[model samples]
Target: MKKILMGVLCLSTLLCGCTKNKDIQIDDKKVGQVKLKFDHIVGAKKLVLNDGTYSNNSNETFNINILKYFVSNIKFTKTNGEVFTIPKEESFFLINASQSESLQPTLNIPEGEYQTLEFNLGVDSLTNTLPVEKRAGVLDVATNGMYWDWNSGYIHFKIEGTSAASPNASKSYKYHIGFFGGYETRTVNNNRVIKIDLTKAGISKVQENLSSDIHLMVDIGKVFDGPNSMSIATTPMVMHSGPHSDIADNYATMFTHDHTHNFQKIANNEK
Candidate 1:
């Protein structure tokens, strides 16, 4: 009887060991969510900048008529050489000021450390041709003025500022920047990416579930050197900001290195 009991106990122990090993094996191919947030550091909604710096001084503040842009193709890179891209179906994001209060927004990320991030500064050809009824977020027909009488496509960015530099206005420089059409020179197209390898390495140990909020600084001054290369004299009208789009492309210059950002952590209640 003792031998029989010992044999039964050993069999139970082996089964439990196998079950425990199976439980410890986590699926490494799980998919994670990628979030995006934006911040428009415009000095004031109604106010404007003289030398691209927001100020309370009357001489510095200029009235703005419109300011909008599109962000698309949000992507991520893992430290181990893996890449994740926004699904082709829902990749574009519109970063409009009228829709949101500020420019500094947070992005949602999965539960792993990312090696790099890539995003577009303006709308792409695929999104531009999308009909108003099909648009979402900043691309909504109600907000974005990209509609060219239902014939043309959406404008990538509509930034209008009024100032002395603006169309002979009393204001300093009222500027309006937007895409013209689906197949016109007025349309704007620009994309940018950054390597956050160092930053990713520093925070690799952090679980994505722990960090939910991330900060990305958007500096308009860096986008276009107001008083510098992009002077009011040269880029006064949409036609000017377009043909000279290369000059306007400096917005990337404003995109600097990464910094400490915030996000949600794994919930204590979560198993």
Candidate 2:
């Protein structure tokens, strides 16, 4: 009878602990939302997917058919240097050029005055190590074809198009970049930072006037001629290629500051 009584007491203690944990989760503070818009363009004109012809710094002409990439580890830093990092598990995003909705979507953020926005241009190392079955959200390889099965890693960025320099009949060229271990990793840093002024958007405190949108531009011409220039005739494609650090690094820096708009000021939504 004593053993039965002890077992009942232990079970009650366990249930109590679980209830406390549940309450902690439910007590999380409410936050506001921010939007980020991406625009793809050439020197001074908007880019037309698969049809617009643009010349690179290297004087090579090309047209992009598909452009998809991943952005993760988004963090916002205030002028005072206080940083707010998005929850790692829920921060991964896959962006496709064909999808307008993907250009700018509202994302939840803690109430704060953010002056600088930063994010990774490719999948982070942690998500790169996980298998498809074990991943979730945008990192789920099953839903997104960003996974490379043969080499074992996510394709952080992909650019498929046709270049006049291509020797093939289709004049097709492709660049796929990622982390594949060993010397192939190429030691390239794919993180990008952008200066932002959220005051104009009326984002001053947690949940105060939270509707803010920032627009950014991605220049395709920069891809072939950033710090270095790429020739499609020499390197038209990279699927399983172990070393694509040059092209990856070039395209990673293509993002530039555009304009921000659609500022809707709502009262502090904090709970």
Candidate that would win on lDDT: 2
Off-target runs (Cα >4 Å) in candidate 2 are 1-30, 180-209, 265-271
Candidate 2 residue lDDT tens string, 142-251? 66678777766788888889988898888999888776442345545433433444555433333434455666778877778777778888888876664477777677
lDDT of 1: 0.50
C-alpha positional error of residue 219 in candidate 2 after TM-score superposition, expressed in Å: 1.2
Candidate RMSDs in order:
12.0, 17.9
Which numbered prediction scores highest in TM-score against the true structure?
2
lDDT of 2: 0.70
How do the residues 147-222 of candidate 1 rate in per-residue lDDT, one tens digit apiece?
Answer: 4454455555455565554445554443333343346454444433433433632332223344433445555644
Mark the 10 consecutive residues where model 2 has the least summed lDDT.
Answer: 20-29
> What is model 1's C-alpha RMSD?
12.0
Instruction: Please report, in order, the local distance difference test score of every candidate based on alpha carbons.
Output: 0.50, 0.70
Off by over 4 Å in 1: 1-37, 42-65, 98-110, 131-133, 170-209, 226-228, 239-244, 262-271
- What TM-score goes with each of the models? 0.63, 0.76
